[model samples]
Target: MPESNTTLAIRVQGLEQKVPTLDGELQILQGVDLDVKSGESIAVTGPSGAGKSTLLSLLAGLDMASSGEIWLAGEPLHQMDEEQRANLRGRKVGFIFQSFMLVESLTALENVMLPMELAGAEDARTQAENMLQRVGLSHRLDHFPNQLSGGEQQRVAIARAFVTRPDILFADEPTGNLDQANSARVEDLLFQLNQEHHTTLVLVTHDLKLAERCVTRVQMVSGRLEAL
Candidate 1:
């Protein structure tokens, strides 16, 4: 087992991912090593098919790497089973997806409350309301995802991700679906919350401007990472 680092939010060493394809083995990531300190922001930038999303999934415990050691928020992700990883994620991780993956059947407030509710939090509703208000979504609390516009839905997603105040926040193309104005607004909101919460942010984005906003930046190329 790899030794845990209290000052590190994420540590990846000798990471590799391989999938057996019909043609042959597909290597999506190779020998990836990274260390993100607590409360730091990093952007993973890469072109399509460069294993950017795969790395994010592995680091976030959504999937296991073929070979690697991953320590997330002081927990050994590589050594954990699915259930253990899921529990760890529940306690320390939050995610915002490019598509604004909200529950259509639930209202904005309900969506934001889901994580805390799942964790058996007694004040989930109140915390969710407060987070929504912080994201400027107090007026849209009762609105469903389908009823909201793209920007509004993303705001709801942001509120949901931050409602639990996870130690690490993983955002994949957070503003990919928004217009210029909305993108700027969301960018500001993301950084603001990151600062206030002192959360470690790992973002995967194609937008160079967004990447530049991060304190640290790295680019993925042909399954390898390079400093930018």
Candidate 2:
């Protein structure tokens, strides 16, 4: 755990993002600031095009900010080159997406093992298998993503995200594509991992049930941060 005063795991201050389009320069996020503590769970809620996902992408280093500061685990995201950003993300960040971004060509086990392989962990296979089993996908290890149902595919994706034991997780609308039953199950699994691993969680979700369950709720309006 980080020391009390330094327990912050993610920080953003005075952030701004813009893009040039036919209409004009579009501001996606404006002077947004936030701090995420170790082991904290925060849900960011906003309407579509309010920059929820865009902000997350920036936080995850999948995209760069137009200006201002973003620090993850004390490393300045804006100062890093692409190689450094990729290294940092691989070492500390995990992601879960609404689309269940599983590789179609890989089997469940293979998908889960990819991260460990990249990290060059000697016991990658064992660790990946354990993660898959914990997610209730042990029986489907050899099944390809295309052969699995939506729920099962998501389970595999979740397992993949945990295989490296990331320090923080960024989930974007994790339950969006699922039915109520599947969504509930995935929700349980997510919180279970949080409790078990004490992973820092930052999520952008529209589901009221999931949103309210987070430790904090951040509202965004017109690309500006608002009261919870």
Candidate 3:
């Protein structure tokens, strides 16, 4: 194990991920290292095909590393199996994707409840309701994903991601699909929620303004970390 960075909410060291190609192995991450602190917001910036999303996936333990380690909230992500990782994620990690991965079949309320229900959390309903209201979607509680606009859906996704009071939130291009007005709305909502919960934010973005709002900015180029 690497010497754990005590201030980090998420930590990675010598991390690498590769895939077999017809020609040879394609490296997506190359000995990358990073550390994010509790209550800190950091934006990951890079051009397309720069492995920005791949890096986020590795950090979140949504995918495995060829060789390396990720310490999230003081637990070792690499040491956990898929089921163990999933369990740990439910307890500690939250993810907001560009496409807003809400359950199309379930209403917004039920979608948010899924996590709380999985944890068998007491007072799940009350907690879920509060989360929906916090995201400014109280009136759309019974609405399905298709029934909401892109912005609304993203808001629902944000509500769901945050409902767990996670120690870390990983967002991949969260405002990518929205218009300027809606993007600003969602961006402001993120800061507001972070303030309310003091949740550490690890956001991957192409938006410069979004990146600047964070306490730190991490850039990637050719699958390597670069100073911003």
Estimate, for each residue in 1-228, the C-alpha lDDT of model 1 and write its tens digit: 245578899999999999999999999999999999999999999999999999999999999999989999988999999999999999999999999999999999999999999999999999999999998989998999989999999999999888888999999999999999999989998999999999999999999999999999999999999999
Q: TM-score for all predictions?
A: 0.98, 0.97, 0.96
Per-residue lDDT value at 63 in model 1: 98
Better of 1 and 2 by lDDT: 1
Q: Which stretches of candidate 3 lie over 4 Å from their true place?
A: 1-4
Name the TM-score of candidate 2: 0.97
Estimate the overall C-alpha local distance difference test score of candidate 2.
Answer: 0.90
RMSD of 1: 1.1
- Best-fitting candidate, measured by lDDT? 1
Candidate 3's residue-wise lDDT over 18-123, tens digit each? 9999999999889899888889999999999999999999888889999988998888998989998888888898989999999999999999998899999998
| Local distance difference test, each candidate | 0.95, 0.90, 0.91
Q: Give me the overall lDDT of model 3.
A: 0.91
Error of 1 at 188 (Å): 0.7
Give every collision pair in model 3.
none
